[model samples]
Target: MRSPKDFFAPLALGAPEPLREVPFRPSRMIHFFDPSNERMRAKVPDIAPTVDVLLGNLEDAVSADSKDAARAGLIEVGKAWEPGHTQLWTRVNSLDSPWFLDDVWALCHEIGDKLDVIMVPKVEGPEDIHYVDRLLAQLEARVGLERPLLVHAILETARGVANVESICLASPRMQGLSLGPADLAADRRMKTTRVGGGHPGYLVRTDPVPDGDDDARTSFQQDLWHYTLARMVDACGTAGILPYYGPFGDIADPIGCEDQFRNAYLLGCVGAWSLHPSQIAIAKRVFSPEPAEVAWAQRVVTEMGDGTGAVMIDGKMQDDATVKQCRVVLQLARDLSAADPELAAAYGLETA
Candidate 1:
């Protein structure tokens, strides 16, 4: 095992020098659909066209009896799916579960070439990632796979959140980390019964009125996930991997879900999970930068010309740092445009 000094040395070098060049396809929103659900499974072909990432979920929501079926369904889907811009991913059972071994063994041997990422659940530390990494490498070597499959960890436990930075850097094959709020709340012993959104019970109480008016307002409720989200953003940013907001279980409250996702997006999360079909459009809309913001970024790039020095924009100072920010948006726009032509047009990009 590598020492702590080695574990942190790469981050100390900084952001891996911006990848030399960006990938052609945009990874805006990773839409999560349960392959075990007949309705969702039936919609996969139709859904794949609209989303940037199509993930077949096998953990959490799938019933125990249906685990085998989900595995079979995913294998069939992976085999039948032709290469496309939309990347294919699957969330496997957790390492502790009876099903996880089979999930990995079958997937690695059967559809390893077709799969892009294997989402590992409840990852608590670097050890968890190391296990998956070694296993995946072994599997790839056995199958004579040309490219290594990537791994994504779900940061849900308190220990997982605390160890996120190390986990992100545990392996070169680590792709990203996602917030799993439901399991996190349970793991942390949080009192709220709600999944991943603001709860009145979890809020601060208002002060009592001097005149004894019970209806008087006091302190307002703040986001419960503020610290976790910020910490996750910093960890992911530091490690050069992407961070994502997990699913908001209250599918009926699309507005609240959007607000939660927007908070994560503003805080530097690259994408979010969409549990229901209704949640997909909300995620796609929230995670992508607004056209006004994108247009302004484009203007800044155009104004800078050479992208080396500072200048004034709307009487405000713009510099190399600001231009770098603009490039972030431009890269995202270009990637999204490549992935979905309709979405590209909606964002005012010229679609082919």
Candidate 2:
């Protein structure tokens, strides 16, 4: 391991100054809105403060004819970003797309200062990040932009998931990882038709059913993306960045959406994608630990001073491992309290 003093040295010559040692600002929900859509574009000012990150999407949901329009829309929306309450970000088209160059020029050249991070989709490995890193630096230099733009990689392909560690380490501008379950499932040839949720057929069932009584069988469902999310979280945490669970398409089922986001939150993901206005509250609620949970975590920490040895809290065992878990909850709560008054209130924290 490198010494503490050497930890923040620049990762590459032209890469953004290292933000590795800085604490990740809270982004509990990176709300996705198509910049090309008029209704969505209109919602930016209203929703910007409500979300931790406002992503003006320029890929996938955007049609070919709207590519230029999307770029223009992003510029308009980015320039109006609310600094602390919500960050302004834009998802550029894939690297191979014809419009990718134009998208970069519009956002990074025009309103780069207002933009926080640039989300790159279909990231297969570090090489992709390296290309964007170099290009972004060149553009920043060319445009005389003061601050370096950060990068957030979308792990949508199987290859991206496999190479997440390298991608996160590829640049100092790296912000976090977001799991794109739709494309990931397609790439992996998964049998699920729904976007980012458990399939009915994909579950665990009691074996044999008590002497072959098949009619009495009981089944237990599982989150199909658990493995990928876990891998992403471990990699992001290792790199000292953030990890988020991307979109849940079953918007009508708030329960399932909450459950999915909650599971990801418990498993170390810092936030998730909110595709609709309705889903934003769910993501926020699930990502922030409940007041009851915060209380218990605080109790454990108070009992385990110096963060060693063991203690008992409410008849449950609290040891080194448990203390570590409590620390995670408390730290997130404390950091989230800095900007989010609602979240601070939810976690029983005082806010000014």
Candidate 3:
């Protein structure tokens, strides 16, 4: 069995060196909505209060002809948005795209103070982050901004996945990494046509039973994202940056989406993306620890006192290793409480 030190070593590496001295806030769900969409844009103000993070998407879903419109729309939306506990973020066009340069230039110059994070898509390596880092630094300096705007890389390309570590460590402004499944699947030439979930055809079957025995039943529905998500969790965990599961395209199938997000959450992901309004609650529900789990963790900490040595809880063993898990929940509760008092109360936690 591994020691407590070995299990907790990942936390040290996974956490980025504290920069800007900003208070650690719980970004449980980074909600994505198209800024160019009139319906979505109209909903932003109300949406801002409900979600932890609200992102204005200017890429992928936006039309070629509407690139300029999307840019303007994001700026207008950013200018008008009153930053409450909800952080303001924007997903710019990919670095390789023609619109990206203008996207960065416009957002930085127009609403640098308002924006919290600039989500850079298809980040293949550290070089992509370096370029943006330098440009953002220059922009921040020009705007006379106090704190530098953070960057969140989208792990979508095959090259990006291959170079995730370098990208995560490329800049102090690198806040987190988000797994972009659809683009990654396309980039990797994956067989599955569906976005971000298990595929029934992509699985292994049991071998035929030996002589005279009945045919054995087999497993069904393989997790197509297992390899990628595991690698992503390892990469982010090792780097001290946050790991998030990307969007579930089938908004109608909340069950499958919840399953995917829950898998990521259990694998140590901090959060997941919610593309539609319906997905917001699912992501929030899955990402946070259960009440029973939280209460149990609290009991362990309360009983352990100094947090050293073995103890029995409900006839199960818990030691220093369990304290770390308890701390994880307590820390999340503390962070969430700091971010939103109402949510803290909803979870029955006292606001700090």
Candidate 4:
């Protein structure tokens, strides 16, 4: 019954990580595709450029029977992906599963150089991350790879949420964490059927409909994932890693998906997962800072002159705090536009 945090405390104390700092990667839409599916697998090259990150999903989507096939398919597709334009990531089967070790072993040995990040799902605590970190280091050494592979944790289970801070601080290879709302809801046994969205039943009624028919009642729907999302954002921020919002399963309702992504973005998430092709655009749009916001931020930053003393901008206070917010928006805009040509065009960025 050792504490999860103590397991990695020695490394966290003062030791420098063997892994190099990963490149500044923008993952506005971590597009998910099943490598085992021929139709989806074939479209990687063409569709990859359209999204910031292309992920070969070998977890929940791939059945038990197709695990082997999915592993092979993922290697083939991952090795062939264009490195500079899009990040190649994979969601390996959970560590608790039988295939987990094999998936990590083969992926690192076979395609370690090609893969940018390996996402671990249902991460419960720091111990889970420490295990993968050790194994990945060994595999990377075995393959003679120059740069180590990065790890992304999916905070789905309730235990995972509770221990996210330790999980993010577990390793230098830790890239970020994404909210798996579907699994999270199920893990919590929440009374909702929809995936990654607000439930009408989980709402606030207006004084039980005063002076109106009992049946004629209305309530304002509230975001179900707000608390978890905010918590994840803060945890990731403290650890100097990124945070992302996972998919919204209702592919038919793009508006709802956009709203969910926007909520996350406003609350400090850098991006979200795009479950379907259509969601790619929504994620990109919602995650990127709007033109006006970016402009205002730039103005405030320029006026502040080194982000110090207070000033007035359009009758509003502009101080150290306001400058910091402005910098966040501007920095995010720069990152998103760097990888997205369409976004660069919209941002009026000139190319080389």
Task: Please report the candidate that would top TM-score against the real structure.
Answer: 2
TM-score of 3: 0.90
Model 2 worst lDDT window (10 residues): 7-16
Q: Which model, 1 or 3, shows the larger TM-score? A: 3
Score residue 192 of candidate 4 by CA lDDT: 80
TM-score of each: 0.88, 0.93, 0.90, 0.92
Q: Each model's C-alpha lDDT?
A: 0.82, 0.85, 0.81, 0.85
lDDT of 1 by residue, 1-352 (tens): 6774454233222222112212335556788877776777788789888777899888888899999989988888888887788889999999999999899889988998999889999999999998887677677777667676778899999999889888987876777888888899999999877889887755676777788877667767789888998898898777777888887989889999999999998898888888777887888888777888888999999999998888999998998999999899877877677666776776788865
Off by over 4 Å in 1: 3-25, 204-214, 346-352
Per-residue C-alpha lDDT of model 3 across residues 172-279, encoded as one tens digit per residue = 677888889899999999877787888888877667665844445576677888888889888877767788888888988999999999999889888888888899
Order of all candidates by lDDT, from best down to worst? Answer: 4, 2, 1, 3
TM-score for candidate 1, please give it: 0.88
Residue pairs in candidate 1 whose N, alpha carbon or C atoms collide under 3 angstroms: none
Candidate 2 backbone overlaps, count: 0
Question: How does candidate 2 score on lDDT?
Answer: 0.85
How much lDDT does candidate 4 score?
0.85
Clashing pairs in 3: 14-240, 15-240
Give the Å shift of residue 111 in candidate 1: 1.0
